[model samples]
Every structure is written in structure tokens, then in C-alpha cells.
Target: MSGLKLEQVVKRYGATQVIHGVDLTIEDGEFCVFVGPSGCGKSTLLRMVAGLEDTSDGKISIGGRDVTRLDPAERGVAMVFQTYALYPHMTVAENMGFGLKMTGHPKAEVKAKVDEAARVLKLGDYLDRKPKALSGGQRQRVAIGRAIVRGPEVFLFDEPLSNLDAELRVEMRVEIARLHQEIGATMIYVTHDQVEAMTLADKIVVLRAGRVEQVGAPLDLYNDPDNRFVAGFIGSPAMNFFDGTLHKGGLRVPGLGDVTMAAPRNAAGAVTVGLRPNHLFLAEGDSHVVELSEQLGGVSYHYLKASDGTKLIVEAHDQSAPKPGSRTGLRIDPAKAFFFNAENGLRLR
Candidate 1:
């Protein structure tokens, strides 16, 4: 269990810069997840930490040692990739012990380490089997077990669950979480899936276009995003954003309706109003849900369109859902509304 730190990290290919200057720190035994869209340079950042990709400029330190120019093996980190890179012909035990064997570890020591990892990963029953004989999840576990046998100071996962089916992904996610708790190893996981980031991370680092957007607890990012982008990216259905103008003591969603809030201390001009679908409630007196839908379940979503076609997604977990053309009332607690500058997308207090 070691801490990792990046200081003004940058990566460039030729003259094209991919990773902007980034600074972050992961505490010892922390599970930090890196999340962003494709081409966002998340994998590039992870690779740099692994010593697989050189940093264009800046410093990387692991366990208080500067490893900026060290080789991957010298960095004391083990990586698990999306593809299970187990040797096809080797048996599970052989594959798990291969690294130690190559490193000149004694035969007995290698066997003991491999056996311990197998037991920890529940692969003891499949030690003699080859990768071909194991399920997708089991193969991934073997890949992880191989890392564990090496006894690394930190674990780096690059979308390790991306290749699995949805159900298996969930199962493996729990497995990884348990591994972290049991082993207490510092881990840095990269993924584009927000759900994965939210579910698995002790802290999440949200990136955009190679720059750090926000780094915080999952619920912190969901409930108090620093900008409109962060707010929309961290949630399930995503927070609803609409063009609106700041008024005397509130904001107005043109065509749909207006919500008056406690006067913003220092607010003005045009702004974007945000509503999380889970927060939008169907009420009779003040709330107006313009459109509704029932997805053949107890929890149905309502898609309300303003006269100007501005859309809002509302969740009606119970009660009857309205038809597409039918109208329903909606209530938005002004305090629950998020306001961002329309032009800059920055939050307004």
C-alpha cells in the first residue's frame, strides 16, 4: 500500500498534446478512479504511471520515490488490462508464478506465492486449468491474481471490466472492491463508465479533453458539481440542463415554467438551470409534468417538453405515469435546482 502523486503531468505525441498539465495525489490505500470520455487521455495518464508511457514533462512519484524515468518493473506497480493477458498454453498456477520465476525467485517461494494468490482469488480449484477452460470472470481473476503474486505497492487497472458482459461486469466490480478492502492496496482504475466510477471509487477524478475537471467523492460530484459538465456527467440519467435567465430571486425555464429560489447573493444575466430526474417530483399544486411515460414498471420516467421544446426528465417511481400527449404537474424545490453560467458553464454559487 503506497501513495501516488502526479505533478503537472503532461503527455504529447509529436506536436499534438494529449494530456494537459495535471496534478493529483492518491493517498495510501485509496481507490481512485479516473473517468472520462474516449480520447480524454485517461489511459495515457495511467500508462505514464505504469512507466509504459513516458511523461512529456513533470514528475511521478510512488511511495515517496521519484520514478519519473524508471522502468515499469522498477516502479513497483502491477497493471491489469481490459484483455486478460494470460499465457494461453500455461496452466493457471504457472501463469501466476511466471513473473516471480523470471525474476529469479526460488522455486519454493514462487510456489508458495502462487498458491497464496490462488487461494485469495478463489482460483485454487482451477490451478491446473488453462485460460481456455475458465470463464471470462475467472480469467480476469487469474489476471488479477497474477498481479497479486507479484506483491506490488500499487495496482493500476485500465478498463479491466470493459470486455465483460453487463452482469459479469457488476460481479467483477464487487470482486475488485472486496479485493481492495481485504488487501488494502492503493489502486488507480481508469474507465469511461460513470456508473463504474461512481460505484467503485473511494474518490473519482473526472477528466475532460485531457484536463482535470473535478476530483472528489462520488456523491460529492453528483450532488455538488463545480460546473455543468461535471454535474451532467456524474449522474445516471444525467442532470437536465436548460437555458434560463436569472431573475430577481430565481430562474425561469422559458415555456415550461419558473422556479423562485432564495435570492442568489451574487447572480445575474443568463444561466443554465439544472434538474436531476430523480429530484423532479409529480405534484398537483405547484409541480407540472408536461409529459409522462411508463416503461412497464413501477418506476416510470416523464419527459416534459417546454413550449420551446426544452426537455426535462422526471422520475415517477410510483403512481400512474401519463401518456406522451397528456400533461402532469411537476414540483421542483428551488434549492434542488443547480444554476450555471450559460456562456462559461461555471456554477453560480
Candidate 2:
């Protein structure tokens, strides 16, 4: 296990600075996930840590050693790419042990390490098979096993499950989590998928426009986002936001009435009211109803619009949502609402 620290890390391609100064501390044996939308520099930051991309400024330390300029191989970290970069000509065993071979380890030692990794990853059954004969999930396991045999201080995954089918991705996600627990190795994973980050990370780093927006546990980020960007980004249906003003101790929605709700700490001035889809409930005396309804078997979603045209989405277990164009009342949970500054998008009480 190893702890990783990035102090004011920056990455720039000529004058275009992609990753802004990012300072992060990943604890030993913790599974940290870097997540954001495309071009947000999540992958570039990961590559910087893996030494695939050079740091434009600041320092990167793994296990207390400054390795900001070290080569990928010299950093004592192994990276598993999204493509499952396996050598087609080599069998699973050879592929897993390739690094050991490349480093000129003894044949017997390499064989032992490969066998151990195979057993751990359940790749023993496919030792002699090439990448073509393996399923997507199995191929990914081979990729992970390849990293496992390296015995690196840290494991870096770059959207390692992106190529798999939905079901396969879920399975691999669980497998990766289990592997992290069993090995207790420090892992840094980069993905655009919030579900993956929510499930696998001990800490999630939410990024936007080359800057770190927030870093917290999954539920911490979900329940207490630092800004409007984070509040909207962390949730599934996403937190709903519309133009609203703060009035004394309450909030006023443009198309809706003055909502008597507590604001998040430090909230004042012109602020946007933030509420999650799940936080809004169908109420008896409300004035929003179904503009559209989508029923996905066990769960139903109602896309609603207030009398003045404010859109709201509600996810409910109620399988019988009103049909499109039907009017319904909705209630907001006062305590669950968040308020953000209109100017900078930061949370305010």
C-alpha cells in the first residue's frame, strides 16, 4: 500500500493549460476516483501521475518519494488502460508475466508470480488462451492481473471498464473493488461514470474545467456538495436548478411561490435553489404535474413543469405516474434543499 500526494500539479500543452494547479492527498490503501466530463483533465491528471504525461508544474509523491519527473516504469506504479492493451500473440500467462520477463527476472520466479496472479484473478482456467479467446470481462481481468504481477506501490486505472458491456462493467466494478480490498493497495481510478466512482471510491475527486471542484466520500459529495456544479454533477437525475432569489430566511422561485426552506451554510445574496429529483415529492396542494412520464418497470419518472414554466424531474417508485399533460402537485423537502450563489455557483446558507 502507498499514499500519493499531488501538490499544485499542473499540465499544459504549449500555452493551453489543461489541468490547473491541483493539490490532492490519497491515503494509503484508499481507492480514490477522479471523475468529470470530457476535456475536464481527469485523464490528463491520471496520466501525469502514471508518468505517461509530464507535469507542467508542482510535485507528485508516491509513498513519500518525489517522482514528478520519473519515468512510468521507475515510479513503481502500474496502469491498466481502457483498451485492455494485451499482446495478442502471447497467452494470458505470458501477458501477465511480461513485465517480469522484460525486467529480466528468472523464468521460475516469473512463472510463480504469474500463477499467483492467475489464482487471485481466477485467470487460471484461461492461462493458455490468447486475448481473442477471452470475453471482455476476462480480458480485463488479464489486464488487471498484469498489473498485479508488477507488485507496484500504486495501481492506476484509466476508464478500465469503459469498453465492456453494461452487465460486464458492473461485474468488473465489483471485481475491482474486491481486488482492492484483498490486496489493500492504493488505487487511483479515472472515469467519467459517476456510478462507478460512487461504487468504488473511498474518496471521489470531482473535477471541472481543469480544476478540482470537490473531494469527499461518495455520500458526502452527494449529500453535501460544495457548489452548484457538484450538486448537479454528483446525482443521477441531477439536482434541479433554476433562477431564484434569496429572501430573508426563504427562497423565491421565479415561476413558483416563495419556498420556505433553509439554505446551505454561507448562502446569501442572489442564489440558485438546488433540489435533487428524488427530493421533490408529489404533494396534495402543489402546482406542478406531468409534462412527461417515463415508466421503466419497477421505477417511474415524472417530468414536471410548474405553473410558471420551471421544469422539475422526480424519480419515484410509484409505477403509476400521471400521463403526459396531466396536472399534479409537488412538494419540496425543505431540509434537503441547497442554495448556491448565482455569481460563482458556490454554496450559501
Candidate 3:
């Protein structure tokens, strides 16, 4: 229900700094996700926002109140961790109301809040059941319900669906999305899964080595990345990168049968060319060898190795798949290609 802000937030351990000076703003009711690879400090940043970790130097504010020095209990934020830390001895209803009960809320008020949370999480039927008696998804929902009863200003999720099976993960993702829609509360989620960020977030913050890589909508980052890391990290299967030489008239790529294509404006010397799997297709002559083909019902992924030993992946929607070791050619869509400076990996406009 309240917006959150961080100004020059920083975290350090002795001589090593894990979180660099970061500035961010989350509008009220916006669902923001932090995504990156392991050891990128995404979880650490989230924990700092929750007041579970101390900030080495910086300022954090929630709903116009500075909470950088406050304890976790006073931050007006509820965190749902990766593990469902439910009490086995207590029933679903009791667990959901325990916080309020311990805080001196009356029995009738606690009961009403617990009931409302159960109804919102669709756990009304399992109120009397213990954590051991419920399924994994049910237990997770109970944990979420516990948070819901507190009525926090912001919700923090730290890979809450990591323990569930694939099917259950998908199911819980839909459930969480619906929960956000109904409650309309500001949420900050941390995960290493870009797919989750793509599906769940209104805005995504991509991190690398404790530095902010990019911050934008999921598709915005995917479609137009500022650097090579963001471009490579945002898409599934990753984008194929090739070494190219920019000449007077065009760019020459040795991996693509030494093909020459139109170069971008102001680009010169050595450059990197990037192409997505869906933008490259199997063509007529043999310039590459098929390594493997993965058929996934609706689409197939063809893994190929060019004569220069460069690897590439092509996504094909048709049912036919070429056999391994078969020689083939590739056709890349010029309009969809991306050019980057080879030395620094910055996009060339």
C-alpha cells in the first residue's frame, strides 16, 4: 500500500563491498523483481530492505519514513522466505493468527484476521489442519496467509516458490499474481530466475557483481538492452554472439560463412554481432553442423556449430528436425541483429 525508496544504498564487509551505492524508487502498488545470477547480491539487497541486514552506508525510506536504522519489526514489511517456516504443532488458523495474538490483539480480532487471510489465500478448508497434513503448495499458501494477516505496507518475497515442483511452481505463480491484483500492495521479489521476473514483475532490476546493470520493464530490457550482459541475461537460451569486423561498407562475420552485412552508424573496427534463436533459421547451403535438436512439442531448438567452432541455437516451430552431424546453412534476419563494441560490449545504438 506504500511506496519504497533507496538512496545511495551500500553494504560492505570489511574491505569487500557486496552492494554498491544504489538508488531506486518503487511506486505504490508496483510489483518489482530483482533478478540475476548467483552471487549477484540480489537477495542481500532485499534483506537490507527488510532490515534483516545492516546497511554499511546509505538511506532507506518506506512510505516517506526513514527506516534505515529501524529494527525488522518496525519496518512495516513482511517477508516470505524460500522455506515455509511453519509451526508443525499449530493448526493453520493458529499459525496465521500467532503474530497478532502475541502482539496483544483480542481473541475475536485475531480470529477475524485469520479468517480473512485464509479466505484470501483459499485455505479456508484447511484451517484446522496442521502443516504436516497439508501439501507443499497448501503449506506455502498458509505461510503467505500468515503474512497477509499482518497487513504490511510492502511484501518481500525471497524465492518463495523455489521448493515447489515445476507444476506447483507454475500454479503458485498464478496464485501470487492474483494475490497481488486483489490486494494491490507494493511488492519486491528477489530471484535468480529470469522467467519468474519476466512473468511476475512490472519492473525488473538486473544486477551483476553488486552493480545495477539495467532497470526497466521485462520486455523493455529484453528487446533493447544497454550492454552485452543485459542482452545476454534477459533472454532464454541466451543470444548468440559472433565476432565481426566492421569495414567501410559492411560488417563481415567469419562464423557465418564470412557473410557481409550492413553495419550500424558510427561502428568501426572489431565488433560483436548478436542474434536471437528465433531470428536465425536453417537455410540452403552447409556452413554449420547440427550438434543436437531438442523437440519440445510446439517448437524445436536446433544446436549448431559453425565451421569456426562457434555455437548457435535456432528455434524452429515446424515439426521437422534435422539429424545430428548434418551440415546446414543459417539465415539471419538483418533487421533483428544487434551490434556491440567488442572491447566493452556496449550496444552500438
Q: How far is 280's C-alpha from truth in model 2 (Å)?
A: 0.9
Tens digits of per-residue lDDT for model 2, 202-243:
999999999999999999999989989899889798888867
lDDT of 3 by residue, 1-349 (tens): 7999999999999999999998999999999999999999999999999999999999999999999999999999999999999999999999999999999999999999999988889999999999999999999999999899999999999999999999999999999999999999999999898989999999999999888989999999999999889999998889999999977668999777679988888686798999999999999989999999999989999999988889999999998999999999889888999989999989998
Residue 77, candidate 2: C-alpha displacement in angstroms: 0.5
Ordered by lDDT, highest first, the candidates read 3, 2, 1
Displacement of residue 255 (Cα, Å) in model 2 is 4.8
Instruction: Return the TM-score for candidate 3, rounded to 2 decimals.
Output: 0.98
- lDDT value for candidate 3? 0.93
**Candidate 3: Cα lDDT at 151:** 91
Report the C-alpha displacement of residue 161, candidate 1, in angstroms: 0.7
Model 2: CA > 4 A from native: 247-249, 255-268
Which lDDT value does model 3 have at 257?
A: 66
In order, candidate lDDTs are: 0.88, 0.89, 0.93
Ten contiguous residues with the weakest lDDT in model 1: 255-264
Residue pair clashes in candidate 3? none
Q: Tell me how many residue pairs clash in candidate 3.
A: 0
User: TM-score per candidate, in order?
Assistant: 0.94, 0.95, 0.98
| Model 3 spans > 4 angstroms off | none
What is the Å distance of residue 76 in model 1 from its true position? 0.5
Candidate number with the higher TM-score (1 or 2) = 2
